[model samples]
Structures are given as C-alpha cells and as structure tokens.
Target: MTTPQDPENRPPQQPYTPPQQPYTPAPPPLSDSELAGYGQQRPAVPEPKEVRLSFFLWLAGAILLVVSSALVLTQRDAALEEARRAPATPGITVEQLESTVTAILVFLVIIGVVLAALMVFFAMKARAGRNWARIALTVLGAAVFLYHLIGFSLVGLVIVLVVAAAVVTLYLPASKAYFDSVKRAG
Candidate 1:
C-alpha cells in the first residue's frame, strides 16, 4: 500500500563510483650521503701560507725564549758581582742579597720556559684553524710587548717584534678567510 513517493517504493539504489585521482610519482628516498648520521666530508681548503709562516714565527719565538732564559741564567754570577759592588742596603748582608737575586733569576727562568711552551701550543692550535687559539696568541703577544715595554732590552726588542709580526700575519685577509672557512666546515 506504499505510494511511489515513499522510501520503500524508490528504485533499487546503485553503488557509489568515486572519481579517479590524477597520477603523481613518489619522491625518491634520501641517499646515504644526505644522512647527517653518516660523517659529512669537509671541503678541502688549502691552508694559507701566512698561517704557516705565523706558526713558524711562534715556534722561533718559543725557541728564542728558552735559549735566552738559559743565557740569562749563565750571567747570574756577573749579576751577583754587580750587586755586591753596588752600595749595599743598610742591613742586608751580601749573602742575603745573593740568595734573593738567585731566587728571582730562577723564578724568571721557570716563567720563561712555561711561556715558551704555551706559545708553541697556542701556535699549533691556531694553525689548525682555531680562532680562539689565534686570539689567545694575540693576548700573549701583547703581554710580551708590555713586558718588553717595561724592560726595554735588545733581546726583548727582538722577541716582541717577532711575536708582533706573527700576530699580524694571523689577521691578514687570506688568513682570516681561511680560518672562517674552517670554522664553517667544522
């Protein structure tokens, strides 16, 4: 008794047919080299000559420090004699003066050797493209310059000049670029 307009009177329904999608290719997988876990190869940038030269200069400075310290110690006897000839302090005995002078010279020699070793180590690290190392070398160089400024001796003049030159070379345009590149690569 259902009418044609009723739900039970409607024609048999057809299954839905979805519209086809256009074909698109899948993206290729990442290559082994693209993986960060795999060690990334650093670019091969040749070291600038200036850096090499600066390293050599630092090495020379270190050697000079060691040799100069030894030489200064050898003159301790003369230094003591000069101290004796100079007017003695009111109550300080010659023996006491001698002991104090000897202690000071020995302390200076120990400082010299330690400074030399530090210079060489910093130079090596700087040459390997460590900017911090270069900066440290500069600070140490400034120290040497200041020390010489106070003493103002012939040997000190040479040492100061050498360190100054080495520091200068590190800041040259090519050397700066080299260090920058190395920094970026690592």
Candidate 2:
C-alpha cells in the first residue's frame, strides 16, 4: 500500500533499437572505358636482342655438332688404322681395338644428334619466353663448356668457347628483363 509499489522495483524497460539496414546489390562490372584506362597504364615491353642472339648461337652450336659428327665418321678409316698401329694391351688385340673404335664412333654420332636436338628444343622454348628453358639452356651450356674444356683438344676448346658465348648472351640485361616480363605476363 505504500508509495504505489515503489517505481524502482519495476522490471527494467528494453533499450531502444535502430532499424536494420537493407542488403544492397553489388556494383556493375567495369565498363569498356575503365578497362581501356587500365590497359593504357601498363608499359609495353620490347623484344630483347639478346634472346635472338642466343637462339642463333644455339642453332650454330647444333649445326657444328652435326658437322663434327660427319667429320668423325669420315675419319673412321684413319682411326681404325691408327688403332691397328698402336701397341696392344695384353688382353686386347688389334682387331678388338679396331672394332672398339668403330663402336665408339657410332656411339658418339648418336650422342651428337641427340644433343643437337636438345639444343634446338631449348633454343625454341627460350625464344618463346620460357624462363625455365632459358635457365636449362644456361646450365646445359655450362656443362658442355666444362666437359669440352676438360677434353683438352682444339675442337673441344672451340666448343667450350662457343657454349660460353651463348651462356653470356643469356645473362645480358635485356634478356633478363624479357624473362621477367614473360613471367609476370603469365
């Protein structure tokens, strides 16, 4: 009966709430003008001269390998004669040595053709802006150069020098930029 059931004793009233926001649709796709503006911002890349030089060098190396194989085949008779004249080891006869020389020459010819084909394949891929191909060619070139250098013959030295030149060309600044651009574009 006192003070009309004390107002403070009543349950707390609910807090005021804001109305919910409606879901909005996404913006429309970019128009042609916007796309054109984006396209215009990127600078154009030029083809690197180093790439072309590398390709030509690889082609030359392949051709040289073919010619060298031909020369080796032509020298087979002389090689056989030389093998015959050499003093034979206790276990190996002159006939065996001659046959061995012939077999070695044939194996070398097959290797030369395979290597030439690989060189051409790598060169073509590198020309198409494949960074991996460029790297592969560089590594292969270095290996070839080292192998030929260790052989210590005039022809071997020539091959070593040519391979060195090709590797150097690939490392040029233009070639690096070309490879980088290709990677970015993809």
Candidate 3:
C-alpha cells in the first residue's frame, strides 16, 4: 500500500537531440575563361637558365678538349721525329721520349673522360631543378670564361659569361614565376 506520486509535481523528460549536420554551401559556378586557368596551373618549381648554360659550357669544354688533344698528338709526333734526328741530348733518350708521349696521351684521355662525366652530372642536376647546380654552373662558367679569355681572347668566353650572369639574375623568384607561366602557356 504505497502512496502514488502526484502528477502535478512531476517533471517531463526531454527527448535526445542529435548534432546538426554541417552546412556545406554549394560552390560558385565557374566561367569558361576562369575555369581554363585551373588546367593551366604552373609548376611548383622551375629550373634556371644558368643551370642550362653551365651544362653547355661543360659540354663545349669537353668537345674542345678532345679536338685540342688530337691536334696536340699530331704536333707531338712531329716534334718527336725532329728530336730523334737531332744530336742525342745528354739527358734525353728515345725510351724517355716514348714514355713521355705515352703518359701525355693517357693523361689527356683521362681528362676527356672526367670532363664528360662532369658535364653529364651537371646537366642532370639542372634538369632535376637543383638550386645548388645553378650556382655550381655559374662558377664553372666563370672559370671557363676567365681561362679562355686570358689564353685565347675568344669572344665566346665573353658571351658565355654574360649569358651565365643574365640567367642567374633572371631566375630570381619573380622571373622564375614568369618563366613558369610561359612554360604553362605553351
């Protein structure tokens, strides 16, 4: 015989409410020209022209080395013939002359191979968009220019140096962006 609670004093329980869904407003419609810009997105990074020039200089150097080596070999043979006919010098023997020629030829071959390898390495680095390669190339180009300018006074050296400088300058962030834009456009 328990007494019942009074309804007038009892409180009603509220129903559980789930979280509201996030409102994702519809995207604005794209216009034809504006939509095209999306497909024309630029690359994240671009290679510098200095990097390219450096590679080319390395290539030219290798080529010149080969040609010059050939010319030297021909001249060396002529000189060796002349020396053989001359009075036997006290300090020089045929064996020594032959050994010297062989050694020089071997050294030149080694130089050619090394230079070729360096050129390829730098070219690959430039293609891969390494900034340090650009710097390396600039230094290499400067070295070549100075070496040739002093010894040969060749205008090609001047041109290469000037181009190298220009490329380095033009590859600044703003210029790089411009280059990227042109690349994307094409």
Candidate 4:
C-alpha cells in the first residue's frame, strides 16, 4: 500500500509532537527605587538624639533667617532718613535714594524667605537619613560659616553660630553611624 515516493515504507510515519508541560505564570515586577539597591527593605535602625537635635537646629536657623529679614525691613524708614541726611553724591536725588533702598530691602526679604524654605527642605531630607542631603548641608554650612566670618554683624553672627552647631551635630559619632546604616540599607 506504499506510494511510489516511499516505495520501502509499509505505512506513513506519524507527525512528531513535544510533550506537554504544566502552566505557570511569571512573577510581576514591583516598584523600583531611583537609587540603587533601594527597593529592598532592610532592618530598622533607631535614630540617635544627635540627629534629632540637628534637625531642630536647622529649623531654628530657618526661623532666624525670616525673623532677621523682617527686623531689618522694620528699619527701612531709618535707613531712608539716614540716606537723605548723608552727604549726597552729585547725581543721586532723594527720591532715587528712597526707591533704591526700598528695592534692596524687598530683594533681601525675598532672598531670606526663599533661603528659609530651602533650609526646611534640607533639614527634612537630612533628618530622614538622606546621605546626599547631609553632604550638601555640610558644604552649605561651611560656606555660610566662611561668609559670616568675613562679616561682624549681629545677624550674621547668630546664623553662623546656629549653622556651626548643626554641622557639628551632623558629624557627631552617633549621626555618622546613623548615616552609615542608612547607606548600607540602601
């Protein structure tokens, strides 16, 4: 019964088929962190008192910047008066003097308020054990310290002292260990 093309075959060979396997669904991917090795949860670490104190100091610094700016603003009238009474340069007029001083005061107030907002942000992030934030704060604190050193004003002195304390607290042994733990966990 074989065809002429398979003259030696007694019957047509059966088609080949693979053995069946059980169905299994693949695992779904969860949220991934922007930072490397951040998605995996790690054992909890207790925060140290030094870190808390530093956080408060940062908040205080922010408040001080705002208060000092407001206080400086309060002296606007005196500053304007003094400018009016002072020996005048040949070209500047009283109207020009008042406007310029007022503008400068407004600009300074805006800067102070903005700086205070930034302080709060950095403080929260650093307190949460963000290594980058802490490092950034350190750099900023050093810059502030150096800037204040060049001036002898009361406001600058207070800000510098507060920043200096916060920076010191961040570098304390307990704070260092906390940051290290956070890094390891990340």
Candidate 5:
C-alpha cells in the first residue's frame, strides 16, 4: 500500500553498479609480418572432390573443342569437295567460292579456340572456389549442351554429355560447401 511519494515508507536504495565481466582489451593491429603470415595461411577448407572433377571435366571440354577445331581444319579437302559439288552461282568464280569457304572455316576455328580458352579460364577460376565462376561455367555448360542437342550430331551429343556431367558435378552438395567456405573466408 506504500507509494514512491511516501519517502518515510521507501526502502533503502543501493548505488548503481555495472555487471562484472572479465576485462578484454581490443586486439592490437596486425604488424606487416603478421599480415603476411595471414596471407600465407593455408585455406581451412579443402576443395571438394566434386569441384575438382568438375574442373577436370571442363578442361576436357576445352580439349575437345581444340581437337574438333583441329579436325575441321584438317578436313579442308572434304569441305572443299562438298563446296565444289554445289551448283555454282552465276557471279561467283570457283576461286572465289573456295576462298569464301576457307575464310568461313578459319573464322569458325578461331571462335572455337576462343571458346576453348574461356572454358579453361572458367575452369581455373571455379577450381579456385569462385562462386561467380562456377555459376558462369554452369550457365555456359547448359548453353553448350542445348546448342549441341539442337544440332544433333555424334560429336555434339558427346559434348552435350560432357557439359551436362560438369554442370551436375559443379552443383553437388560438396561443391556448394566448398564455394560457401571460400565465400566465408574471403
């Protein structure tokens, strides 16, 4: 029945005191040697086997692309023969037709080499646990698979299978964990 306003009825008050806690000073700023040591520390998380396999698969795809380009270049005679069989257009001479076909083949080979280089680059990055690189490689794999499927050749089917395998491996749980660990560490 006592109110705070009734000073005669109020209980004794104690001085405000902060809760006791062990004193912990902030860590000192790292020295140049310490910072260098941090850089030298081994990655706590080892890369998953799935990621390694995926990288190897991507490398294989790149190799395949290189081999296909070489094959195309070597088959110039066959391509020329096929071109010769086609009914000649009124204005285009045989030399012109051959030159045009040669140009197109060269351009295709160049594109193949460039794409192969990209695949190798992405594979290396993905191996280093770059999530963006993994995603990019996965998307590229899917695109390649779809393109090959649409084209429907024996070689295309082989490429589709390889890319599909690589994409699947890249998305495996172990691979995801490795990528997540890299993200956390960075």
Candidate 6:
C-alpha cells in the first residue's frame, strides 16, 4: 500500500475485443443439376444457323425472280416493235413471245414470293422456339433443292445443294428437341 504509481508500471490497457455477432453462413453456389433443371445450358436454346440459311435462300430466290421478270418486260416491248414492222408471221408473233415470257415470269415471281414468305414465317417461328418450325423449314428447303435442280445447271445446282444441306444439318433433332423443351416451358 506504500508503493507509488509509475507510468510504466500501470496495468497495460485490456486488448480490444469486438462484441460477438450471430454466426451466418453464405448460401452455396448452384450445382450443374440445379442449372440443368432451369434450362441454363447453352445448347438448350435454338441456334440461329438455320434461320440465317433460310433468309439467304429467300433473298436469292427473290432476286432471281425479280431479275428474270424485268428482263422479260424489257424485251417484250422490243419484240412488239419488231412484230409491228412485219406484215405477218404465221407461227411466231410478238404477242406470243410477250405472253409466253409474261406467263413464265409471273409464275416464277409468284412462286418466289410464296417461298420467301414461308422462309420469313419459319424464321420467326424458329426464333420463337417452335420445334415444328424446324421440320417445316427442312421441308421447304428440300423443295428449294428440287426447284433449283430443275432451274439451275451444274454449278448452281451444287450451290443450292450445299445450302440445303447446311439448313438441314443445322436444324437437327438435337436442336429441335431443345426448342421443344423451350416451347413446353412457356
């Protein structure tokens, strides 16, 4: 009781201690199975490859039909002028040439427009995740293949075959199945 207090001898301050808090655990990351259930896999979505092929096919078809139609129209007037100068031609006539070309061009253009519309329709359906769109597009593409075979020579036929193959390949069963699942989900 007689000892004098010394600065150095003073009791060291208690070590700082934070107040206790409730223990909390972070939620675990989702597993692959959990993600699969939600259809988070990349392959679950419909691929756009087939849609692109369809669009290109429709565009080329439209251009060919339009150019052919224009050529027939431009040549029709010239043929008519020639026919007017001639007194008479028993079998051949400008009217016949014009009508024949016009008929052929109109038929080709109509077919082209129909196919193009179908292409756009299928593309939209595919984008909306319709499985049936795949089959429909495949059929249309096959039809295009046959049409091209009759309309085009060796080189053009080869090109059409390649495009058709690409479309059919891209819209395979796996992709269709994925789209079907997506359709069911919505």
Pairs that clash in candidate 2: none
TM-score of the candidate numbered 1? 0.71
Flag regions of model 4 displaced more than 4 Å.
Answer: 1-43, 85-87, 142-156
Which candidate should be chosen as best, given lDDT against the real structure?
Answer: 1
Give the TM-score of each candidate.
0.71, 0.67, 0.44, 0.70, 0.70, 0.49
Writing each residue's lDDT as its tens digit, candidate 6 over 48-120 gives 5554555465446445534443444455565556646768657876667667656765675566567656756
True lDDT of residue 66, candidate 2: 70
Sorting all predicted structures by TM-score, with the top scorer first, yields 1, 5, 4, 2, 6, 3
Instruction: Give the Å shift of residue 28 in candidate 4.
Output: 10
How far is each candidate from the true structure, as Cα RMSD in Å?
12.8, 11.5, 13.0, 9.1, 12.1, 15.5
- Per-residue lDDT of candidate 3, residues 77-114 (tens digit): 76567667778768877899877766766665565455
- Residue pair clashes in candidate 1: none
Candidate 5 stretches with Cα past 4 Å from truth are 1-43, 146-153
Q: For residue 80, what is the lDDT in candidate 3?
A: 68
- Name the better of 5 and 6 by TM-score: 5
TM-score between candidate 4 and the true structure = 0.70
> Model 4 over residues 13-114: C-alpha lDDT tens digits?
788989889998996765555355465343357668998899999899889878877876897998788878888889997788989989988887787677
Best by TM-score: 1
The regions of model 6 sitting more than 4 angstroms off are 1-94, 153-159
Model 2 alpha-carbon miss at residue 15, Å: 60
lDDT of each: 0.85, 0.77, 0.56, 0.79, 0.80, 0.60
Q: How much lDDT does candidate 4 score?
A: 0.79
Output candidate 5 Cα RMSD. Answer: 12.1
Q: After superposition, how far is residue 77 of candidate 2 from its true place, in Å?
A: 3.5
Point out where model 2 deviates above 4 Å: 1-46, 81-87, 146-156
Worst lDDT window (10 residues) for model 3? Answer: 147-156
Arranged by lDDT with the best first, the candidates are 1, 5, 4, 2, 6, 3
